[model samples]
Target: MEDRYSAVVDLQGDSKQAAEFSAKNLNKNIMLEVENKDENELVDVVREGYLTTNSGFLKEDVNGGTCCVTALIRKGNLIVSNAGDCRAVMSRNGVAEALTTEEHMDGKANA
Candidate 1:
């Protein structure tokens, strides 16, 4: 998470704040879920963070949206966790490879 994302720099009461909520909480929730030892825990945390943070923003009547990405490299495995439009990509032998494709705000795979 970026330092500026620590909180909403400007209280626009808009989606930017909600996006900050997503980024900040994604950092927090991922740590909370790490102990589950589940392979998909990162992704699950991202999903939960998205909902929980947005819920708070909505409860406060803040408008806007959030998107996030999470990834873990463990035991020689590259795990990609994507939520919203966040994506990951890599290169192999000068070839670019997409780890996750961009999707709509609803969190569905791109068609």
Candidate 2:
């Protein structure tokens, strides 16, 4: 459990760093303001981070685990991604809303 938690934390931290670094470098270069390029880069960074973390675990002979990652950027972008049985929830007013749908063992959403 601890290892899994650490992996998720590392992923989040790395992704955040990537986003910040991308924004800083891109802001300095005026030629990189293409449409949706920043968003695409953010997505790729998150995906690569997840893959790297997973591969690291496999290389270390660690057991598999699940994780839910939620990243809220300063630009009002809310990104939520998960694997296995994890899910994300948000509270609106007095009601609870699920940001992500639950997944069943049969590879179907449990909504």
Candidate 2 — which pairs collide? none
Q: For candidate 2, write residues 1-111 as lDDT tens digits.
A: 355433353433444444444344422332223233575465554544455545444464334344544443536666554544567787899899877765443422122
All models: lDDT? 0.61, 0.47
In order, how many clashes per candidate?
2, 0
Task: Tell how far residue 45 is off in model 1, in angstroms.
Answer: 4.5
lDDT of 1 by residue, 1-111 (tens): 655545656455466777777676656755666666576454555556556555666786656665556666655655565656567778899998888776555733221
Task: Output the lDDT of residue 100, model 1.
Answer: 78
Give RMSD to native, each candidate.
10.4, 11.8
* Model 2 spans with C-alpha error above 4 angstroms: 1-37, 103-111
Which candidate leads in TM-score? 1
For model 1, what is the alpha-carbon lDDT of residue 109? 24
